[model samples]
Target: MGKLRVKVDLALCQGHAVCMQEAPEVFRVNETDGHYPKVEVILEFPPEDLREKVMDAVRYCPNRTISVEEIPD
Candidate 1:
């Protein structure tokens, strides 16, 4: 498998934190005082070993904001 590139659409994100729940190592939800929580990509290019969890994060995102692309090494 190739390296994985993960991205999140901030505009559409609703601070659900599902991605963080699914893949804590790759995704994080930042909660601010006034603003809505936002997702942070801790690992933009996670290793192949994390493909399954990363895909789970992508699949389970309620807003479908998370995206993953496979990059050839």
Candidate 2:
């Protein structure tokens, strides 16, 4: 699997949990504060199926806080 860097814009994020609901493994919203402490989860690329799920998360983010950048080695 290829590597992808995901970054979240906290300033733009409105504490919405849509990203979290879409990709809990990659993005999570704090239940106490309803905010994202750190949304970006830059681990090794997940499996193909999960990649699709992550893509959905990025695409569906209400605040458009998530971004996926593919890195070429």
Candidate 3:
């Protein structure tokens, strides 16, 4: 399988944390003081083993802010 490049659109993220729930190893939801919570990509290029979970995050994101691109390995 090719490498996975994950991305999150912070402007569209509402901090639902669905992506985190789906793939904690690849995504993080940080809620800081005085700022709206946002989702962060913990692993921009996760291992092939985590591809399914990462894809789940992309598929289940409530705001549709998560995306993945396959890069030639």
Candidate 4:
């Protein structure tokens, strides 16, 4: 399997946790008292086995802020 990188743009993200729900291993969103933080964190390199789910998260993002790219080892 190949390596992949994930990234999220906070400016474009509206606190939607779709990516988080789809790929919790790759994306994270902190919640506080029912309110979610504006920033979303993307893991640098998710497990190669999770590529399909990561791609699903990318497609599920409404703002299209999520990005996944294959990296050279």
Candidate 5:
């Protein structure tokens, strides 16, 4: 699998958990101080097979805070 980088914008994320729903293996949400939970990446460099799932999270993020970039060799 090719290398990849993933990031989530905490300021923009609403903890909707759509990313987690799309790729639970790569994303999760953490409740913070009783406020809306925050999104987290469980796997920054997911396997090749899970690439699509990661992309799905990026696409499905309600706030468009999720981003995944390919790392060139």
Candidate 6:
């Protein structure tokens, strides 16, 4: 199995939770910490094609804070 990863630039996040909204299994916000705080998350790399989904999240992000990188299988 391979590992899929998502990177976020907190500086540009702008508290947007689109990634979390689109893929809850892969993204989250830690409300306990503060408004729109990223909590422990995972990138659903199988089934629905996570790379594309994460990319969409990155592209749709008004702040452009999300990115998806593929790992060797």
A best-first ranking of the candidates according to their TM-score comes to 1, 3, 5, 4, 2, 6
Off by over 4 Å in 1: none
Ordered from best to worst lDDT, the candidate numbers read: 1, 5, 3, 4, 2, 6
Once fitted onto the true fold, the runs of candidate 5 whose alpha carbons sit more than 4 angstroms away are none
Model 4: per-residue Cα lDDT over 1-73, one tens digit each: 4588887777787768888898888778776565546545657788878888889988988889888677877
lDDT of 6 by residue, 1-73 (tens): 3566677777666556777776676777666455455534554353446656666676777777776566766
Provide C-alpha RMSD values for all models, in order.
0.9, 3.1, 1.1, 2.6, 1.3, 3.4
Quote the positional error of residue 12 for candidate 3 in Å. Answer: 0.5
Give me the displacement of residue 38 in model 5, in angstroms.
0.2
lDDT of 3 by residue, 1-73 (tens): 6788998788999888898888999888999678778988888989989999998988888789988888987
For model 5, what is the C-alpha lDDT against the true structure? 0.88
Each model's TM-score, in the order given? Answer: 0.93, 0.70, 0.92, 0.79, 0.91, 0.63
Candidate 5: tens digits of C-alpha lDDT, residues 13-54: 889999998999999999899788999888988878898888
- The local lDDT score (0 to 100) that residue 10 gets in candidate 6 is 70
CA lDDT, every model vs. true structure: 0.91, 0.68, 0.88, 0.78, 0.88, 0.64
- Tens digits of per-residue lDDT, candidate 1, 10-34, equal 9988899999999999999999789
Question: Taking the candidates one at a time, how many backbone clashes does each contain?
Answer: 0, 0, 0, 0, 0, 2
Candidate 3 deviant stretches above 4 angstroms: none
Error of 6 at 44 (Å): 8.5
What is residue 22's positional error in candidate 4, in angstroms? 0.4
For model 3 the local lDDT of residue 67 reads: 83
Pairs of residues clashing in candidate 5: none
